[model samples]
Target: MKLLPVFIFSFLLNALAVKGQGADTLKRPIAVQLNVGTQGIGAAVNYGVYEKLALRLGVNAIPIKANDVFKISGFNSTSHVSADFYNIHLLADYTPFKQQPWFRLVGGFAYFLKANGNVRIIPSDDYKYGDLTLTEDQIGYVDLNVDWKGLAPYLGLGFLKTFPKRKFNINLDLGTYYLNKPEADIIGTGILTGNSSQTEQFQSNIKNYRWLPILQLNFNYKF
Candidate 1:
């Protein structure tokens, strides 16, 4: 029995060691970068920690809203507008297709800051139809779990190039997030003599299974 344990350990170690890095592989650049992208562009810092893997951390905003969803039927019109969200992500990317120019894939996880969320339903109507409105003041923080919901998945693809002369690399990444369409309650009022029923339960359209592409023009300092 004792010998079996030792043999198993040895076998596992040998399997890991069998993967070899050829001379050209060793020369590949290791890098660190600061990047910005859409959905409230932000700065992210990442460093190559493995043969073709990078660890990253970043923060982005979730400013979401509908162009127009309200038109007071007859005498008044109602519009439902959403506030925004702050999302922070931590992820790892494997540049398996790094050497290629046309393709690259990156996937990871994110932490959404929901406690600092603000949901306001603004009704833009005439003073006569003026009613109550809601802001961060009312439903300041959601009554549900914000931390667990923060955990999300991330995916990205892009074109990459390494400039030997400049000694740095540049790439453009297009990515999106997979979020569990958050279901939260929003209570607000428009400071008017009337109220709108449209903005009442209009939280369903925040976003559903959608890819909000973010184009990142990033610079990487290779070592």
Candidate 2:
């Protein structure tokens, strides 16, 4: 039994060596890539460490804003929605088959420098306080905020090649990141003060929201 285990391990090592030998070797040691997709626009630097392996260091960010997107029944409200996300990551790419150099497995970890989403709703016209109409300034606004600003682990697959066969090439990525537990809260002013009580429920609803999907395209240039 002991000898059988040793034989299996040796066979695996030999198989790995043979796979590496058959892979298309990277002619360039370093390359720069521009990434565009759901995570936003970013850039990465890749370093070929072995024939079938490479390391990537990258950064990405997205900032979004919208107006008049949220409202409640019987209320003339204007809402502003904003989201900002920033991340820095280090990833590894490995080509498992020499015959399929265009396919690769990717794994990485990212530290979110900033990840926050906010929605603020303000009365567009006037609010009736029982018998009187309250001004917009008096009614104020309600703000709902959620934050997921921490480390995340990523796993995905890459298509095409890591580096260009010529000088430039394009690749695609499909992946997802497992984010940390998110925190959520509500803050209100004036008549909206009562909405703050909903913070606990908001937090509960988003507690399990940990997956961040990614569909990206990368343009790479060899150096």
Candidate 3:
């Protein structure tokens, strides 16, 4: 993690030493980008505010579900897992060196409208209490949920030029968002009711999961 910033800094210094043309000559300052990354698929609009600065507004969303992916030791059970994340963001891209406009310093903020994860576990085996087989509902199940929704600040570096020399270009973004602290809950039914007591412990264990890393590719069209 520490090496990333150092590497970018070194590259920036090298870029500053090169001589190149500026974007001031371009007639079209507006662009649109289609993006995909850890934040899922999204689209953004970009506008150059000055020779060295551009602003972007965009939205992204991710919804995923899986079955039988989570398991417990010494237990025969089926698990369902789901995660959803949605956000709207505004970002600024600033080129510090006139000669190397390809490298940019990016700062932004996102409002996560929905960020939640859920897991449900159910016993998959038949249990007997002295020759009496227990039914599925009698065996019970457990559900664990966590949510991190609200404003998150972003900081990172951008690679390649922000806009195209002609009509199209490709760029990359490397960054991370500092998400708000999450709220967690555990709910259990029937025999697993006692599991709800562990909600506090679960929240404590995940208290530091606020850093959400991002690696995205953007396809840009200058209009």
RMSD of each: 9.2, 6.1, 5.1
Q: Is candidate 1 or candidate 2 better by TM-score?
A: 2
Tens-digit lDDT string for candidate 3 (53-154)? 678999999898999989999999999999899999988777887799899998778999998889999988887768889888877899999899998888
Candidates 1 and 2: which is better by lDDT?
2
Model 2: CA > 4 A from native = 1-28, 71-76
What is candidate 1's lDDT per residue for 1-223, written digit by digit as tens? 2353354345334433542443235433445565665655555666544444555677776565664453435634334445455678765555555456346556665666742333333334324323644553332321211112555566776566422225576777788766656554444343431333333344445435234456777767665
Candidate 2, RMSD to the unseen true structure: 6.1
Q: Who wins the lDDT comparison?
A: 3
> Which 10 residues in a row give candidate 2 its minimum summed lDDT?
1-10
Q: 38-133, model 2: which lDDT tens digit per residue? A: 888999999876767777899999898999777778988889999898999887777778799999887777899988889998878767789999
On a 0 to 100 scale, what is the lDDT of residue 144 in model 2? Answer: 93
In angstroms, give how far residue 21 of model 2 lies from its true place. Answer: 7.7
In order, what lDDT does every prediction score?
0.50, 0.84, 0.85
The CA lDDT at 131 in model 3 is 86
| Per-candidate count of clashing residue pairs (backbone under 3 Å) | 14, 0, 0
* Total backbone clashes of candidate 2, pairs 3 or more residues apart or in separate chains: 0
Report the C-alpha displacement of residue 116, candidate 2, in angstroms: 0.8
